[model samples]
Target: MVLISLVTGASSGLGRVLAELLCEKGHRVYVIARRKNLLEELKKQCKNLEGEVIIIPGDLSDGNFRKKLISQILKKEKKIDYLFNNAGFGRAILFEKQNKKEIENMFKVNVIAYEHLAALVLSSMKKSNNGRIINIGSVVAFTPLPYFTAYNSTKSAVYGFNRSLIYELKGLKVTSTVVLPARMKTGFAEKAYDCYKEKGRNMCIEKFNKIAESPYVVAKNIIKNMNKGKEIITPTLRAKMWYSTRYFGFVVDFVMKYILGPKERKHLEQAVLKEDYKNS
Candidate 1:
């Protein structure tokens, strides 16, 4: 039986690697993202693989597009054997400074689209009573750092969503897994840096760069355990540690306040700007 799969955010970073790996595993993979060119390039690169890469480029945030995409896929492929919901982005800004539309789009893409696509894909998975739902979440979901206000909450919602989904999937071979990963070297970081630049949050991106993990390694490890039947996967040691922090909210809050508070931002601003009048 050929495994049919849908992988979101497959244009770059972890999603790209996951799509490639799924192809390498001889699974017929449908790669989805907003970037059509990159998806085409991925298709070309994986054309010779055992399985195939079917590029479906569109915005996941659009409900109509999502329903149509799945309808189109199920029309041709029969049934979806797996759902990899890895499409999400984060921004660095305080809650008060965050744009209303930006935050709304963030939730629309990160949380709303995730569940929407899952529901669409799960319909097919249920027919076979066999499939997997893999969600890409962040370690920040547990840590809750100050600058990542909206992004953090979305991840928390993902964790809860996955847990509830697991309970509902009981007695079935299908499983729901949420992978929590820490800092990774990907376009995600570049976009996050740009978000900070626009908002004047000049905390050097270098700090994250120093500790960022390789998306290739992270993606490989995640796929390695795809059938291990774990409800949650912390792909790296750092991410595992961060997951543990969820139990200690008070400690996390204290550390976050100390690390990215106004005082720390002001101090970093002076070093980067050299002439801060009175923003703090």
Candidate 2:
């Protein structure tokens, strides 16, 4: 029997890679994103693959879109075997500088959309007693960065939701696995930086780009762990290190402040001075 997988944010990055991987493995995949062209391109690329791709182009932050997405899937697929809750983005900006709409959008996409979509699919999954919710969280869920406060909060919510789900799913074949990945060499960073750039102002992403890993490799590890029935996964060595030491507040904070590389260090200083001046 073939599996049915739903991957959100499938226009690019980890989500796109995961959708492609699922199709290659003979699983019928439903890819969702705002960019219709990219989703269409992905479907074309997977046309001759072992499985199939169904593209649903819309914004996950929209509640109606999420419902329509699940409704369309349920009409044909019967039950979804895998829910790759991977639709999210991060912007690096000072908390005080972040607009209200920006914060709401972040929560809507990263936290609300994931939870709402999971809830929408859970009924069918639980009734069948066979399904998996693969939550695409980040290491920052545990290790919150200074400038990415709102984004970190959203990821932390993802971790919390998935962990609670595991217990709620006890004695059932249905499971929720949260995978925290390190920095990925994807459009995520570029988009994040671009979103926050205000003429002369800049967000330093040099170090982040430097330490990034291939999303393809990360997606492979996530699939491997999912198959092995793992609940919590930190795929990369760097991700593991960052997550493992999350509890060491003082050390992590120190490292986050002073040892995040000179560029980031300098950026942080400038941000602080600028904020202080504005407030004063």
RMSD of 1: 3.3
Q: What is the C-alpha RMSD of each candidate to the true structure, in Å?
A: 3.3, 3.1
- Candidate 1 C-alpha lDDT tens digits along 84-164: 999999876545666889889999899998899888888678778888999998888788766678888999999889989
Which pairs clash in the backbone of model 2?
none
The CA lDDT at 83 in model 1 is: 89
List candidate 2 stretches off by more than 4 Å: 194-206, 261-265, 268-280
TM-score of 1: 0.90
Top candidate on lDDT is: 2
1-280: candidate 2 lDDT, tens digit per residue: 8899999999999999998999999999999989999999999989889999998889989999899889899998898999999989887666776778989999999999999999999999999988888999999887777678899999999999988888898888888899999899887877665323446444545546777999999999988788655779999898899888967978877777777634453555554345432542
User: How many clashes show up in model 2?
Assistant: 0
Runs in model 1 with CA error above 4 Å?
Answer: 195-203, 260-280
